[model samples]
Target: MPWQKTFTLGNKRKGCHLITNEVVNAIQDGLQNVPIGILHLFIQHTSASLTVNENCDPDVRSDMDMALDTIVPESLEWTHVDEGPDDSVSHTKASLIGSSISIPISNGRLNLGTWQGMPPPTVATGGARSRNIQASI
Candidate 1:
């Protein structure tokens, strides 16, 4: 049988937000005892992105986020400033970070490392926002 699930995340930034184990747990909960299959996870937005990162340390996330900001600073000379200073940067970051990830499922479980976890969704200003992640099994 095939199943699909949607996860809603409250992100604090407008950039790359690493999901947490809870999101993975939700996917696993839906795929429990489903045998071998492919799990596809997609984020439905252009200004946001998804990624898998080291969840063992919160500092890692902070460092990575900071690095992205440095690489794609909001003050860069961008033409698509109709929205705001962060509008173009948001799109650029999303393009670089990507919008989806697919993983293989085995024995009804996700193949992930001990120190790895879903990167929580983030925004630029560290404000509250919603993210939709679709998981198919």
Candidate 2:
């Protein structure tokens, strides 16, 4: 049988942060019995996204945040001002980064590259908020 669970992560900062361990911890119990399967993770927010990338270096994360800031600068003129300056750009950044990911589960473990892990994207919305994530295995 397949397993599914939804969990919320609270108060992530305004940039990419590694959450691989958190993800695993959230669904580890459900994953224990599965020998081989696929894990799909979906983030339920428009201003944030999910992606697998290098988790070894802190620079990689900072660089990504900087690059995205350049690519989708919050200073750009946008009509969606109800949220803040980062509003529309946040949506754009989320679209560019994506909101979901798939990973292979082998022997009840996530099959990811040595350097590849999940780093969630975030747009500085001026305040910290919760992010909902759904995991299916």
Candidate 3:
């Protein structure tokens, strides 16, 4: 059987946020029943994406934002700016990073690497202020 849950997250920001706990806690009850399985998460919006990365240091998250800003700097000429300059940039970043994550479930816990955790990377000022991720187990 596959179980699915969509949880709300995000706000006005342009960076990566470690929301692993928030996602795991919401699906803890469902996870406990599955001794071995997979936890698949899909972000429901564009312009934001999910990724597993270093978790212990706050600097890493902030650094991620900086890195993305550097890679997708607003200095380039973008065609779609109906919303703002961040519009085209946000879409591009979303495509580059992606919108979903999958993790193995072991003994009712997510089997992530020691330094791995998932965050829906926020990009571009035109992206959604809040977002939702659909977790399927």
Candidate 4:
């Protein structure tokens, strides 16, 4: 049988930060007695996104966020400035990263590597924002 669950996370991005564990745990909790299957995670948003990355070191995530900001700096060069400078950059970041992730479920748990974890949701503003994540098991 396939099961599905939706979750939201509160994120306030100063620049770009990772939201670790919450989503993964939700998926795990949802799949808690499923035996074995595939887990599909989807985030319904463009300005923000989801990813699976190293969760062991906070510095790794910080460095990655910094690098992304440097690579796609918010400037006035984009034509999609109807919203703001961060608008295009937000879309660019979403395109570069992605809005969904899929993982394998085994023994009623997500079969992720020892060093792997659910990356934090990337928020574009300093204010509180919510991400809708759908987990299908």
TM-score top scorer: 2
Give the TM-scores of the predictions, in the order they appear. Answer: 0.83, 0.95, 0.90, 0.85
The lDDT, on a scale of 0 to 1, for candidate 3 is 0.82
Those runs of model 1 whose alpha carbons end farther than 4 Å from true positions after fitting are 14-18, 120-126
Best-to-worst order by TM-score is 2, 3, 4, 1
For model 2, the stretches where C-alpha displacement exceeds 4 angstroms are none
Task: lDDT winner between 2 and 3, please give it.
Answer: 2
If both were scored by TM-score, which would come out higher, candidate 2 or candidate 4?
Answer: 2
lDDT of 3 by residue, 9-113 (tens): 746476788888888888887798788999999988777889999999989988888888789877799888887788877777888899888899998899999
Error of 1 at 17 (Å): 4.3
TM-score of 2: 0.95
Position 24, candidate 4: lDDT: 60
Q: What TM-score does structure 4 among the candidates reach?
A: 0.85
**lDDT tens per residue, model 2, 40-129:** 999989999999999999899999999999999878888896677777888899999999999999999999999998998774465677
For model 3 the TM-score comes to 0.90
Query: RMSD (Cα, Å) of candidate 2?
Result: 1.1
Clashes (candidate 4): 2
The predictions' CA RMSDs to the true structure, in order, are 2.4, 1.1, 1.7, 2.2
Q: CA lDDT, every prediction?
A: 0.73, 0.88, 0.82, 0.73
lDDT string, candidate 1, 61-119, tens digits: 87877888898887778888775677777777778888887777788877767777777
